[model samples]
Structures are given as C-alpha cells and as structure tokens.
Target: MAFIERYSRRTRWFHAGIYVAVLVLLATGWWLALGREGRPSPLARVTGLADTTVHLWTGWGLAGLAGVAVTVGVRAAGTFLVESVRFRRGDLRWFVRWPAAVWTGRFASHDGHFDPGQRVANLVLTGCLAVLIGSGVGLAFIDGGIGFVVLRQIHRWATFALTPVVVGHIVIASGILPGYRGVARSMHGGRLRVETAKRVWPGWLHRTQNR
Candidate 1:
C-alpha cells in the first residue's frame, strides 16, 4: 500500500511532548490529591521535594509547548482546529450508529477528517486543556491572594475530568480496539497507509487526491 503524510515532524514531536507531560502531571496530581498523609509521592520520592515540583514544572512545560506550537505551526494548528470542528455529511449518522457498531463489531462509514465522535472528543479535550492552563496560571499566583484558592479547586477538578479523556484517547489511538489496529503508527512515523486512510478518512483522502 502507498503511504500518505498524516502528521508532520514538528506536529509529531509536539504530540509526543504533550503526551509525556500529561502523564507526568496526572501521576503527580493523583498522588498529591489522594495519597496518604506523610507518604511521599513517587515523583517526590525521586526528587526529594515536599510538594509536587514535577507536576508544577510539567504543567508549565505543557503550557509553553502549546504556545510554541501555536506560534511555530500556526497554519497546521489552525487547519487542525478548523477541520476538527466542522461537521460534514454522514457525521451525524456516524454518531448515531457508533454505539451499536462498537457493540456488534461493525463500523459505520464516515467521510470526514474526523468522525462525529472524534470531533466531539476533540472539542471536549480542547476545552479541558484550556481550563487546565487557565486554572494552572491562577494556581501559580496562589500565594499572592485568596482568589487563587478557588482556582486551585478548579484546576484539580479539571485535571480529574481530563483523566478519562486522556485514557480513552490512548486506548483508541493505541489501536487496542478491533477497528483501530495499526492506527497509532501515523503519529509515530508521520504517515499512514493509503488503504487505512481511505477506510477511516475518505473525505481527507479525496481532498488530497483532488489537489
């Protein structure tokens, strides 16, 4: 099968960085929020910090990386954002049929850059990241005022909300499910098989061919 570019080198790097940062943040955040009193976090055990220095730094790293991606890959980022939100013909039907397909081991046809489920997931993930970043910034200023205490709660809740989204994304992208096998190689190597593209993203493939 032929191959088509699915992700650029810079985009791949950005995604990898975000994944690592999120994993670190989730681990440290969980320990800080739920660990037994007087017990050190795994990260704290390694770094010898009273608080979660790894979490704080990783949050900043995520924010910074997002900023850099917006600045350096503005066109690519804009294209992704636009495509992810735009509804297309058959998208609604795809959403309507998705649950049964999942249960029955069948799949519906979708002709968009992303199916309806993916579009909704992308929107939710984007919103969650925005909340995380905004509340994280406020948390950084927590020592200065009482308003930031509220922000701390908000940040914690946002992190908790993001956990499931992240887990689901990983599960799907890792191709553990029946229909998604080998899908993750696109992000790893920046290309996908033409057959896979035709099956999963016919609209995008059609557009590329037309161009």
Candidate 2:
C-alpha cells in the first residue's frame, strides 16, 4: 500500500503559473526571433501588438516567475537532492541497474524519495534554468548605455544557448516520464495518490506519520 501526502497548495499555484508563463514566453519568443524583419508576426498581429514587444514583456515576466519558482523548487526538492543523491556505493549500483529495472517495472527495488532518473531530470532543469535566467538578465541590461550592437549579439547568443535545454525539458516532461498523470495531478490538485508516494518514496511515509 502506498502512503499519501499533499504537496503545498501555494507551491502548486506557483508551479502552474510558472508553467503557463514559460510556455507563453517561449511561443511568443520564437515568433519574435524567427519572423521576418518588418513583417509583423501573425500571432502578434492577432494579439494586437508587435511580436517583438510581446516577446520582450513576456520574457521579463517569465524571468521574474522563474526566479520565484526556482527559490521554491530548491527548497521543496532539497531534501531528496541531498539524501538520495549523495555519493553512495549503492547509488552506482542503482545507476547501473536502472535500465533493467525500467524494463521490468521494478522501481521499488531501487529505493529513494526520488528515482535516479528523476534526480537527473531535476539537475538538468535546475542547471538549465540557471543558465536561462543568467543569460536573460545579462541580455536585458546590455542595451541601456552598454552598447546596442554588442547587447543584441549577446541576447541572440543567449537565446541560441538556451533553446536546446528548453526543448529537452519539454520532451522529457511531456513525452518520456511515466508519472505524467501523477505530475499533472500534483499541479492540478496539489496532491498525489498514496500509491505514488509508496512506490517512489517509502521514506516520506515514515517521516510524515505524525502529520
């Protein structure tokens, strides 16, 4: 039997907001980046603004939201990161055995608050967001008496650098993970099934028994 606990409602709200903001920023950003110069984007035209302005404002909004989300995610995910990912002999064993476990659906045998794959995903996202945010800030400040041409180049390069990670994140979150429904529910309801907690996190049950 799986144990159940609810994620914080506030956390879920922030997560959902960030997801919406990021997706909007990314879509509008692409139009602004790839659309022909002087030809207003169809999407921007529909939205009744120039695509470039939409992209700029939305990018700023996404950056702010991401900062908030990262602060919260770091705190929420810290425990699993430290305990489950510390260099342990058994961690290597689990890493080596992960493929077979996946094929056989034996996630329980390799125990932790988060599976190794989940840990990897977390790291990827954390690192990518760091880069994205840093680059965004640098890009934003490049044009205010810092030289327009240089700043524009820096902004372009930063955008190029961030694209691959963004694509990879989308693919893994939407296409690859088995816990998509649970993840969706976590965002929607701020709660997960007891079965999920049991399968992925036997430890939490013990710790949260009093609460």
Candidate 3:
C-alpha cells in the first residue's frame, strides 16, 4: 500500500505546462493549416484573432515554454536522454511482450523510468518537437527565401506526423487501457502505488530501493 515518487513536483509542473502549450499550438496550427479558405477557424473565432496570428503566437508560447522547461530541468532532461538511448538487457523482451501485455492485462517488468516503447516514443516525439520548433522559428523570423520555404515544408510535415503519435500517447497514458488504469496519477501527483510499480517496473523499483 506504500507509494513511490515517479515524478518530482517540478517535473509534474513542467509536464503540465508543456502539455497545455503543445495542445494550444496544435489547435492553432491545425486550424490554420486545414481550414477552408474564406471560412473562419473555430479557434480563431473563439480567440478573436486571425488564424495566422493565433498560430504565430501559440508557436512562440510553445518555444518559450520549451526554453523554461530546459532551463529548469536541464539535469533531469539530460539524464532522461541518456537513459532513453541506453539499451538494457530486457528491453527487447519487453517490446516483444508488449502486445500480449496490452491485451491480456499483463505487463513485462523493466528497469529505468521508461520502458522500451516509451523510450522509443520519447525519442521520436523529441525529434518531432525539435523539428517543429526549429522550422517554426525560421518561418517566423527568416525572409521569404528558399530557406524559409524549406523550413515551412519541414514544419508542415512534422506537424502532420506528430498528430497521431500525440493522440495515441494521450489515449494510452490516460489509463483508457484496462491494465493501465490509475497509471495516469503518476504524472499528476508524482507518485504511484508500490505494488503497481513493482508489477509494471520491478527492475526500476529495485533500483530505487537500492538507492
């Protein structure tokens, strides 16, 4: 019945802020990208701004939040990047067993803060965000040249690619999956039941205990 810290308080705040900013950016970006010409975007109507202006400011907000996230959690972010890339002994097995675990309400145990799937997801999401931010900055500030055109294309493609991944991540992490029920609290309150942690991440639990 004991609980263990899964995310620190600062980490939770960072996650919440980044999540909100990303959602706003996505909403504004997609409205501008997909809305029919001569039709007002719903988001723009609600915000009382031009769609292009909303998208521009939301992108800037996301960039500012990213800066704050990196500044406040640089050490943790570095540790996460290092851990995410290092392969562990059971990572392959965890991946192999993931499908069965998802359907059968079972889970494979693994070490570290992220499992293999999560590690891969983190890397992919990070790459997409980096592309979006970099290209967005170029589009906002650079003159209308070939470089700007290239950056715009990159931003458009990356935005489209990231949409599904983000949706899937939310669905899974929000505990809509049977076995994962209650797992979402780990991010909100920075804690998880010891039993659940042991069941889902025994290696990580053991490491934490040893520390």
Top-lDDT structure, candidate number: 3
Q: Score candidate 3 by lDDT.
A: 0.80
lDDT against the true structure, each candidate:
0.78, 0.59, 0.80
Q: Which of candidates 2 and 3 is the stronger one according to lDDT? A: 3
lDDT of 1 by residue, 18-40 (tens): 89988888888787778543677
How does each model score on TM-score? 0.89, 0.68, 0.91
* Candidates by TM-score, descending order: 3, 1, 2
- Candidate 3: list runs displaced more than 4 Å: 35-38
Tens-digit per-residue lDDT, 65-158, candidate 2: 7666458666765664575454445667666765665444445434455556666666665565556566666666665564655555555665
**Decoy 1 TM-score against native:** 0.89
Model 1 regions more than 4 Å off: 35-37, 47-51, 103-106
Q: List the residue pairs that clash in candidate 1.
A: none
* Residues forming the 10-long window of minimal summed lDDT in candidate 3: 31-40
